[model samples]
Target chain A: MDILGDLLLGVQTAFSFWNLTYCLLGVFLGTAIGVLPGLGPTATVAMLLPVTFGLSPETAIIMLAGIFYGAQYGGSTTAILVNLPGESSSVVTAIDGYQMARQGQAGKALATAAIGSFIAGSIATVLIAFFAPLLSSVALAFGPHEYFALMVLGLAASVVLASGSLLHAVGMILFGLILGLIGTDVQTGAMRFTFGSFELADGISFVVVAMGVFGLGEILSNLENESDRTTVLTKVTGLMPTRADLRAMLAPVGRGTALGSVLGILPGGGAMLSSFASYALEKKVSKNPQQFGKGALAGVAGPEAANNAGAQTSFIPMLTLGIPSNPVMALMIGALIMQGIQPGPSVVQDQPVLFWGLIVSMWIGNLMLLVLNLPLIGIWVKMISIPYGYLFPCIVAFCLIGVFSLANSTFDIWLMGLFGVAGYILRKLDCEPAPLLLGFVLGPMLEEHLRRAMLVSRGDVTSFVTSPISAVLLLVAAALIASVLAPAIRSKREEAFQDED
Target chain B: MQGHRTKDFWAGAIYLVLGLATVILARDLTLGSAARMGPGYFPTVLGGLLAIIGLVSLLRGLLRPGELVERIHMKPMILVIGATLFFAIALDFLGLAVALPAAMFITATASKRFRLAPVPLLGLVAFTIFCVLVFVRGLDVPLPMFGTLFGG
Candidate 1:
């Protein structure tokens, strides 16, 4: 009964004229940008973050959340039509979807993706409405020790999941933590690494780092070895799937949604990981596993559903625990902080409108994607043909302007450029920046919790393990690290990500 | 050049230098005790861990036949970074009108497909106007169309 009342309140807020308009605008822009090659949801969100500064907090978050999941929908379009995955999360979709396209089943593949995503998103939205409040209630009991242990688990899991050298990932995490230390110390009023600059006192804005690393850094890499993209565009006919095709997709969609919703709640698990895991699971479970890479209907359905579900449910950790499972969630936290809201369990209790509004908007956004994307498939196909020559400049221009508008200062722009160069170099060294971004966002909070926990226990380190919840979290973190270090699991992890390369 | 010129080696070296730098810099900030940590304790510990990780990575790079670093492409990397820096410097003095187009032009040059032609120039000009309308007029970002140097 209470949930029904809350759901009614959410409907009232989300159905408001302006909120609907912003939600539509967000998904439309998200899809348009997502349809482009070489741009992921993280970069898209980062570039567009400055645009949302002018809107109300509820409307702003609604739009950003729309962009986050809408990109998942758009990515599958490019993957199916042109064999070019527009986002990393859609890489597995390109395998079978592109095969289907080449076999004159482009429309069917697109339809399947849309249908699967809609169903998965709807289910995940409901799951979030039920589970997020429950999770927050548990999180409400967390002390500094437990919180610190939770962050450590999050960081360790991120390192384990990062698709590169474990040592480099750890190094990057430490590097991010150091970068986070460049602001004024909250307790002592001591400026640690400001180098006597007033701008450094507030610290490096995550927006600047995000734009520099994900946006500009991505552009530099795209420009490298600039070969012309040759798209063998497929003709799309029969915009609806057959009854048999629908029947085949149902089981995989259900399984993928179930797996993705669970994984997406875990720290460091989101769209990309969920899709990959779904593909692997589908391959193992299917009776005709050989059909996987050769246009099996389940292949397109499974990963597409999983990715969409994961994208939606990944909001849980960020919304409930104030811990970001991925970089996009990190940006969301940054957005919430900018809106003068501290993200935590209290968000559910104190800002019920925002909490429920965002959850309901996600389902509405998913419905919009299903309705809008099917007819707009042709335009998305055309968007992929936009030359890299023109696109990178616009991105660079946006990055320049967006970073500048953050504080109307050139210092942030300069910092972005520096990080862009660093990001490029790190990429060349096979170091993934995702973990670093997560660490940068978590670093200050991690340190604060650690200090407070120690202070509470009179400097005794055993307090971290003595607390039952904290002990379990620490044990899980230790196990995650140990699993990554184990030679057999390390190789298996590489095998899982091999398809990405 | 003589031994393993692997990516891990350079990455480790960079990390090693950065970690040491963090430790050295944090020395001035009082570390205090674990109970009441000063500003320095966290960074110092993190920096030390980073240094140790870097050392292991460096040794691993030398011992193992790992993936080599790819050849650095200087042109795009330099031009893109250079154009960004130019925009930052120019936005204050030359403003968005002058800075954005110039930066766009330079960024376009980084692409191999770019040419000294009219159509792309026209497109850049059109884009600049659109940005002015959206970011400045519509969103009311506090950027001048022309800079203080223009006496606006």
Candidate 2:
């Protein structure tokens, strides 16, 4: 069957009464969580993992996916209103978005983002519906060697895309791969880094590490400078974009959707890099590049669209292959595992309803977001008025509850606190949390693959880079390392990293 | 001005100590063979990375090119960390019945913006009861409801 037919079949499953309701529930909860500063989709998905134990995996996943993408929409709300990004993707949004808000065009900026996101999300869903089957075939063709190479590529690209020193990023990726190796080895069943502690046997929970690293890390960083900065209190005007505003947004939104859909499939830094890349592309392609920072509607629309589109399509690599592109997808993979569903190539054939239903629900959820977010802008803005003190404690409570509920062990709670402190220290030292979280999430997987590859090749060290795919990936990694060492490229790349150019 | 320099120096010294400790502890574990590898393989690598990163940080501090001291947040950090510790210690002893409510209260009050109001306690009580009914009895997850309700 053609991709469209399969997508229509997926829509048939998704449009059912139960699935539609679940979609709505997912989007509502997702937006609510996303609006809260510092709580990204990873934490939200982890918190909700237990609640979905009763539901069918499809229903649970559709709802969870809703939260993931809806966050892309709702996260911008806080970034624009309060000048504090809810997630890293929204950091660039804050640059132009808060500027617009400060100029009393907060409503216009948000409205364009919402509409642009909807358009981009719709188009991206269509692209996913059409492209996923083909991509799944490609993933299916990959051998163990190819899979290992792909992961290395992901790790390297993530390093390239990270915001700081290239050397630091490489170090962080290696750190993550190492941390991932801490549990019982899959092949020999010999414990790697446990040091005889039973708690260390199963390995560190990515949830604990991620929550501590990004969630608590941000809170601690903010508290460090809490007294120095205050949240902006911007008055919103009309929420409607003018016709001229709409005209200016049209091309960028289209281009952003196209770019983001393709970029979103990259494993490590797809959604985030796509957003920054789309913004840069818009600037370079724009007739008037000078209009960028001064509330150009495309500045708001393009990245917003790209962010949502990338967010939707990012599910491809995760669903088709067992590998996750980012921490949120890793969390999603964990959720799928908890539900007894392995998110790999067989998932499509083994669970067609789940596969199609999820694809169909993305469109429904996007539409639902437009419905919920547009009218509720006032309510969300009111939520931005919440004091950081009250808000942060609630977050801490959720983290405690979520972590404890997973294993029903107080040990995990203590581990979470330990991670919280560690995260705070990392933040103080200017280390980016995303790489750490990514490292922690990918650590175990990388180790499993490494040992498995070694065992298969009878301890052959060259096996990892001998394959054509692996060689290409390693070449790319080497080039990235070389460019980092070059002073000229290093300076240009730093400017790109800062997005100041 | 002297206090600022002293602060960076101490911070660098602390990192150096931590890195040295990691290396020393790492030496105790054999990272296994080059071919097969073992459990300690990754941590040893990470420890080395941490040591290198720490050295770079220490060197950066040594140069002292610019002023870098910022006021440390003692209160919220202590409260957040302390409250989490309190919850962990209390959970097994007091059980979820008393421990959960107390933890929730501590978590709620940890925020500097909150005031000691009766309303929050009431909310905590209601929330605990809801969790017990849903997660413990309703879902039948066999949570640690009470330590010795029947017998130890």
Candidate 3:
């Protein structure tokens, strides 16, 4: 009953002129960035963070959240039209999406992706609307010890779940923790790792690191692979899926939503994991599993659905508990703080309209994405004809502009440049940047909680295990880490890490 | 494949050195005791972890058996790195007013397929102004801009 009233209030707020306008703008820009390769929603949101400084908190979040989902949807378009994926999550979509395009079913593949995303996004929003308050209350039970444990678990999971060697992941995480330690000591008024520079007093900007890894690093990588720019000459036809296609897709869509909604709540690349997991699951369950990689519609639909759903629902932990499930969500938490809103149980009570409005606008934004993407497919497909030479320079230009706009600091731009070089080197070395990013974003939060918990416990280390919630979270993290390291679990992990030939 | 292990080993060694440097740097900072858990606590722990991980990476590189895939193009990678370094140095002195548009134009020129056009140059200039006005002037952000005309 309370959920219904809150949802109603949410709808009322979402329907307002200002909220609606930003929602539209967010989806539009989200789709635009999604269509363009290299820029993901995180960088786009980071770029626009300053622009939204003047708006109300609810309005800003609504638009930013919309951009996130919209980018997920838009990302698939490029994956289908070209083999390029805007992010790792869309990599699976590219597998069969581009294949379907090769078979002259680009329209159907795109339509399925859009519709599946809409259904999945809407369902995820509803789940969040109903489930968030309950989740918020549960989070309210957490003391500092629990938060510290949870953060530790988050960092551990991020390292364990990251693609590549666990050793490298752990190294990256430690590096991130070090980077997070650059600013003045909140506890002792001491500055560490500043190297006597004034900029070091505040630590490295999240925008700088984010832009370096996602924006500049991607551009550098893209520039390297300039030869893979050939577009298929296949014609797109059939805007809607056939009846048989729909029947076959329905079950996969449901499975995807179910998989995504759960995985999205976990820290790490939960959405990306779920999307790939859904595709793999669909193939395993299908009677015709052999048809898995050969341009199957279910392949495109299931993962697309899962990706969007996970992207939307990941906000649950971030909003209700101030626990970010991913780097992007962590950025959103930062944005929330910048807006002077403390995210937690009190948020629901203090700013019901903001919370509900953001939730309701998600559904509206999903609808808007569908309507906007369908027509824009033709436009975006045409955009693919723009030469990489012409296109890439523009992307690089925007990246520089965005990085500079973040704090209007030349130092940050230099910081971004440094990271970009570092990221490129890492990429060359086959070390993934995602784990490093996860580490950088979560490092400061984890430190704060760890210190707070220790302080509250009067420097007793046992306090983390004394609390039930913290104990369980820590145990789960331990189990996950143990599973990765144990000889018995090593074989299964090797299989898990296999490229699925 | 055999030689790449040597590369990885060297890389790990360098990271260890960097981590050690950070530790040395952090030692100068005054971190309070257990009750406060100052900034130095985080970095010192991180530095220790990094050094350990670096050693682990070095060991793994030495032990790995499989043939390494050679996907890295050294020339382009160097070029990209060089360009980024150039941007960092150029951004402040050139004042973004002249620097950004020129850098973008140069990047376009570097791509080989796209020649420099007046349109992109003009667009970047316009964007630079918009960014300065909105982010710096309007928002009061301390960006490094030579604003004799805009009253910096």
Candidate 4:
């Protein structure tokens, strides 16, 4: 009953002329670039964040969120049309989607991904719309201690689930937290790491750091193997799936949506992991497993559903608790912060229109993506065929201009350059920048809560454990860390990443 | 010092140095009691944890065997980063009209596909103008088409 009221509110805002145009633009642009082999939703969002600064926060977010899943839709297109996945989450889809393409089922594969994304996205949007208010109510009860503990759990979970060695992830988090603590201290006004530079007074912008690390850094690393790249577009036909094809995919889509919705809500898990998990699940549960890598329709349907569903529900923790489940959410959190809106439970109460409108816009965006992707599949295939040589320069130009536009400062550009190099080196060392971004975004909040909790309890460190909710959160964090050490889970985590490679 | 995993060894060493530097830099700030933390408290603790993690990673690098670190591609790294730096330095002095093309041109050289042909150069110039028109004329992003160098 209450959801109906919220849905009406969402409809009133989402149907506005400007919102619809921008949302469509976002999905269209997102899909175009998403078809680019190396650029994913994360990079696309980061690249385009500067464009959103000039608009209203609601409209800006609507567009950015459109880009998020729009990229997913486009990525699966590339997965089917070309064997190369435009994004990591679509890797599993490409395995079977490409095989189906070789079998002259490119149209069916693309249609399956499109239709499945719509189903999962529609359902997932409803879930976010309904669940956010409830989670906000629960979060409303959280104190500084509970907040502190939950953040600890979020950070720990990100590191544990992070690819590569657990030690490296922890070290990266520490490094990020330290980097975040740079600039004048808010409470004490003491400069921690500004080194007396006047520009450093405000602290490093997360936009610059993120754009450099994920955007330019990625470009540099990609250029390392630029000479040895190839693309062969399979001719796509028959955009509609037959009745038998649709029937075969029905169960996998349902199962994937369910699995994805759950995993997407977990800290440090999002579309990438969910798609991988759902693919593995489909293989395990299928009657004919051998047909999987050779173009089983379920293999295409399940992961596409899972990926879209995961992308949608991953917004839950971000919208409710302000903790990013992944880099894209971190960018969203950064966008929200840039708009001067603190990202937490209060958003639901203070900005109900924004809260509900974004949820409703996702469903609208998914519908638009489905319509846009099918006819535009040919264009997207052409995009992936463009050599990386030309694309890299354009992306670099965007980065140079994007960072400069943020504060109209050359210093941020220089900082981005430094971080670009740092990012490349970090990647070379087998370290991931995703968890570091998480830590950097969460660092200030973590320290603030830690201090507030301590101040409230008068320095008794045990107070963290004394509070029941806080204690349980800490226990969960401990268990997550312990699980990382269990050797078995560690191997399985490696197994998932290796499968994609 | 000379075991396998040259990459991890260097990564750990860098982390260890960074951790030490952070701790040393923050030594002057007061690390107050737990109940009332000073500005330095979180950084100091994080820095210490970093050092410990670095130590573990370093030991692992020395003891365990893994694949050798991939060789760094200095040419692309330098060209890309250098081109970016050039853009930053030139944007104010040279303006987007000249600086953007220059940056894009330098970046094109990062790949082996770069050349001095008129078409490629013309394309670069056209793209730079398009960017200037969009960001400057259309969006009014405050970048100058012609800067102090041209007496604008």
Number of the top-ranking candidate, with TM-score as the measure = 1
Candidate 1 lDDT, tens digit per residue, A1-501? 289888988898899999999999889877877778777778778888888888888899999999889999998988888788878889999999999988888889999999999999999999999999999999999999999999999899888887878899899999998998789999899998899999999999999999999998888888875656655663467888789989999999999999889888776778888999999999999999999899999999999999999998999999999999989999999999998899988898888889988888888999899987887677777777888798889988988888888998899988999999999989988888988899899999999999999999999999998999999999999999999888999889999888889
Query: What share of the reference contacts survives in each candidate?
Result: 0.89, 0.37, 0.56, 0.79
Q: For model 2, how does the per-residue alpha-carbon lDDT over B36-151 read when each residue is reduced to its tens digit?
A: 66665656666676667656656766785644555556676777778778877876666667766776666555454568777666766777787778767776654577654333
- Residue-wise C-alpha lDDT for candidate 1, range B37-122, written one tens digit per residue: 98999999999999998898888888888889887788998899999999888887888998999998888899888889888889
Error of 3 at A343 (Å): 3.0
Off by over 4 Å in 1: B1-4
DockQ of each: 0.87, 0.37, 0.48, 0.80
Regions more than 4 Å wrong, model 2:
A95-106, A225-244, A499-501, B1-35, B38-69, B95-97, B108-110, B118-134, B137-141, B145-152
Candidate 3 residue-wise lDDT, A1-501, digit = tens: 477888889999999999999999999888877877756777677667766778899999999888888888888888888878755678889988999888888888889899999999999998998888888878788887887787788777876776666777777777776776677777676766676889778878777787777666776777765654555753466877789878877888999998998888887756788888889888888888887778988898999999999998899888888877787787788778879998777677678999999999999999999988786567766665556566655556556766666656567767877787777767666666776766776777778888888888888888878888999999999998888898877776566556522
How do the residues A1-501 of candidate 2 rate in per-residue lDDT, one tens digit apiece?
566667777889899898899899888877876677756787677667766777888898998899889888888888788777766677778878888988888888888889999999999888777677677777777666666676776777676667765545554565556566666766567775567889888877777776666566556665544331244554566887789888878998999998888878775556677788888988899898997877677777888899899999888878887677777788888778878887777777778888899998999999999988787777777776555655566566667666777677777778888778876765554455566666666666666566667768877878877877777877887786677678998888777667632
Model 4 agreement with the true structure over A191-286: per-residue lDDT tens digits: 888888998888998888888898888988888776533444445679988999889889999999998898888767788888999999999999
Q: Note the Cα lDDT for every prediction shown.
A: 0.89, 0.73, 0.77, 0.86
TM-score of each: 0.98, 0.87, 0.91, 0.97
Sorted on DockQ, best first, the list reads: 1, 4, 3, 2
Model 1: clashing residue pairs?
none
Q: DockQ: which candidate is best?
A: 1
- Can you write out model 4's per-residue Cα lDDT over B1-152, one digit (the tens) per residue? 33346666777887899998889898989889899999989999989888878877887777777656788888998999999999989888998898888888888889877667887677777888889888998877888788789985
Model 4 - which docking category? medium
Q: What is the lDDT of residue A404 in candidate 1?
A: 87
Kindly report which residue stretches of model 3 are placed more than 4 angstroms away from their true locations once superposed: A228-230, A233-235, A487-489, B1-11, B31-39, B66-97, B112-152
Q: Return the lDDT, model 3, position A416.
A: 78
